[model samples]
Target: MLERFIAITADFSIIIPFIYLLFKGKIPLTISDKLIYVYIVLTLIRNIASFVTMMLGVYNIYLYNWYNLLSFGIIAALYFQILNNLYFKMLVIAALILLIAIAFIDYRTLLNVRTTEFNRFSFNASGCFTILFILFFLYELIRKLQVKKLTEYPLFWFSSGALLYYSGTIFPYIFIQYTFNNLANRDLYWIIDAVLSIVLSVFLCFSIRHMKHQKTV
Candidate 1:
């Protein structure tokens, strides 16, 4: 089915790049670098968890809550470093606290679910991150324009990736929750996630190129 194909593609699309990046000698090993490594590892783990749950024919269960916490945490850590100003740090902290509360709610919900009829867990995970990504997107775009830093390219690319992801993933996810019995449900989720993965991969590739140019200079 389309769902399975998308899942397999995402598995390879994301896992391969992270593995390559982790081992590449040319990649800088800075704080952002290490946080990125952790992010990718968490991504892989979440994917594996979803794959396992799917293979078991479960409908709503996933590893998204925990792994996504790590992903957002890593992102916040890097953003904190990038901004470095107290005002930005406070904003990031506010976002982090809100996300942590959502994650905790998700964790509690996961403990109580025992059905194959709904996939609210996925919605909660994707939707929460979608909003977070938007916040990050705005912050990155505004910060880049403010500083006039050449490194803005990476921020811009990242913001674009986040924008695409939210548009492709979050919209459908929010609506899909209302229709649990629809057989067309899974495809919607898969399609959005696939798009998100592809968009982010493109951004990461461009970021690597920019980093290489900086190194050469």
Candidate 2:
């Protein structure tokens, strides 16, 4: 019961940023800003769907599979926009394409035997790529010394939040199948994931709330 409550709360916590951005009354002009907006909305939709499916006791692994692909695409696009290097941009595009293909193949190959199981391959790949992107962005930020105050930088918060969540969850997600087979392990995984998710949402809220102060790269 506690686990369920925490998971539900974390899922709905996304509304914090969603509402903040919606009534803030400022249009997202930059590609990164727009991508952030889209990513939040997409996450909200996925969470809602996940909640409903959970209530209905329906198979919902596919929702996560789709969410992982779309979220990675949006995030990769944001990094592509912010990163100045042509090679990094090309790498992002390639990673996005590879992720899509991997997701497609994983879904098709496992649809029969693992309809209810998490898409571990795609999830781990996306998580690793996201971490890599965050690291690359941070490296570029430090190398260029563009922003004097890292806290004031919006993408800094975004990247940090993403890094925290993805890095924290990658190992558990990689072993999700094993975790799911054991009830106690599964509950622990969800609780940890939920906690990290709440932290990520808070960081996203900060990121969007400070959009007005966003510095160009």
Candidate 3:
């Protein structure tokens, strides 16, 4: 019963931000804001596809692998847009290239072994890179002190959401194979992931809603 509730919540939570965006009837003007909207739309599509594949008992791990790459690329672009430091932007560019290459190689290697298995290395690598990006953003945010009210800042909410979700899930993803082989409750890790996803979605909703009020960062 709890698992079903979590699954349903996690699946539908993303819609909240979409609905809020529609309700506002205002398009985001900045590149960073636009990227966030794109990320949300893609995430919703991925969730639907994942759910459909699961219902059909299909191997959906590949979907997540693809999504990991796409998600990292989008978020990296977002940080690149918002960050002012030339050095940080260059670092983002370099990290994006290297990480995507490594992730693609990892994906191809895993495809040869078993398509059904999780792309653990790619997922974890993306999480690590994303965490670093968030830290860079936060450091810049502190140094600049542009926004007096940080809560009203869209990137703050977005970065907070990403940080919580990635930091919470990376360890579980690392040990997922062990959990599957040895643990009685394999769903435990996924439940945690779902909860964090829901939290992230809520934060994204806040970020989207605040876009009109706050100047693009």
Q: Please identify model 2 stretches exceeding 4 Å from their true place.
A: 109-114, 180-184
> Which regions of candidate 1 are displaced past 4 Å?
56-60, 112-156, 179-184, 212-217
Task: Point to the candidate with the largest TM-score.
Answer: 2
What's the true lDDT of residue 175 in model 3? 78
How well is each residue in 1-217 modelled by candidate 3, as lDDT tens digits?
9987997799889999988878878664577778888999988998998899889888676777788888999999999887777998898889888877777666653454336566656777788889999998888788878789888888899999999999998888777566532346567677888899999999999898778545444
Candidate 1 on 1-217: residue-level lDDT in tens?
8666766787656666575675566655555555555666677777776777777876444344455555667777766775546776787777777766655554554454543333444455545654564576466656556545545445445556656765666666666555432566756566667767866766665544444322100
TM-score of 2: 0.91
RMSD of each: 4.5, 2.2, 2.4
- Give per-residue lDDT, candidate 3, residue 138: 88
Q: Is candidate 2 or candidate 3 better by lDDT?
A: 2
Task: Please give the ranking of all candidate structures by lDDT, highest first, separated by commas.
Answer: 2, 3, 1
Largest lDDT belongs to which candidate?
A: 2
Ranking by TM-score: 2, 3, 1
Candidate 3 shows a clash count of: 0
Selected candidate, larger TM-score, 1 vs 2: 2
Local error of candidate 3 at residue 68 (angstroms)? 0.5
